[model samples]
Target: MIADSGRSVAFTGHRTYDGTAAESLSAAVERLYGRGFRTFLSGMAVGFDLAAAEAVLTLRAAHPDVRLVAVVPFRGQEERFSPADRVRFLRAVAAADEVEVLAGGYRRGCYAVRNDFLVDRAALVVAWYDGSPGGTRYTLRRALARGREVWNLHPSGGGLAIRPVQPALF
Candidate 1:
């Protein structure tokens, strides 16, 4: 099922995180929940995606209405991950309320397709970005272009900042 954009949040971030990433993500999730975001979309990649999904799982214990959606680029996307990461990925997928695989197998630009899928369904994006160029930047730019609210949980220490949507430069 396609998520209700008004209530859905998409997450994007780096593949690795620092020590305080977990705590910061958990707090951000809690805040978003309090603001009535019921659905969270995770790209289901290794680092920040897994962290976001796990945080939602933790929150689900107290608020059953919170939904976690794992948006996989393709089936078996985790096959290349290390054994431990593969296990983590499986656990998150199993626990997710909904799993949407965009492709039957890995293909060129599949990851970008997955990212677009998340942004298309979510009105709010929660990002763990340090401003480096990559998928996170691409997704954030897409969200901005589409006028989605983006909350950046800057892992480098600036805390959560809600980015303003810029007016179209047409």
Candidate 2:
């Protein structure tokens, strides 16, 4: 069982993933599990968001105690996606142990709201960010400001870079 609500992790990344990104993501999830994080939160966006969720799901086979929570930006968030994308989104939501809708309908800065919520609820943040200007970077900054532990699999310089699995001293 989850040790506490703080024993959770959140993911943030760009829609476009770099090569070897998936492998790096899976490895990080496994390490997080080893570190006693039993809950994983995702924004349920395309690319890295879905990839991170799927990684948690795969690890779930061996780490059945873990939970996947999907945080959607708005009610009809996936309605504008292609048919295949909509199906994929639905499947991911269905796989989640819990779903959180940030708003009843789409609104300006809704994406930011979703990203902030993920960081707020988790003690650990795992992301694939290149320091580009986007939600991933914004979430990373928020996580840092909140003093959450973070691991950047693919940061600006490139390659796998994970923070030590220890609580932040601050």
Point to the candidate with the largest lDDT: 1
Kindly list the per-residue Cα lDDT of model 2 for residues 93-151, writing each as its tens digit: 99888899989999999999999889889998988777678888788888888888888
Q: What is the lDDT of residue 169 in candidate 2?
A: 19
Pairs in clash, predicted candidate 1: none
After superposing candidate 2 on the true structure, give the runs of residues whose Cα lies further than 4 Å from its correct spot. Answer: 1-3, 155-170
Query: Could you tell me the TM-score of candidate 1?
Result: 0.89
Q: What is the TM-score of each candidate against the true structure?
A: 0.89, 0.86
Instruction: Give the per-residue lDDT digits (tens) of candidate 1, residues 47-117.
Output: 88888999999999899999999999999999988898899899999999999989999999999999999
Q: What is the lDDT of residue 21 in candidate 2?
A: 69
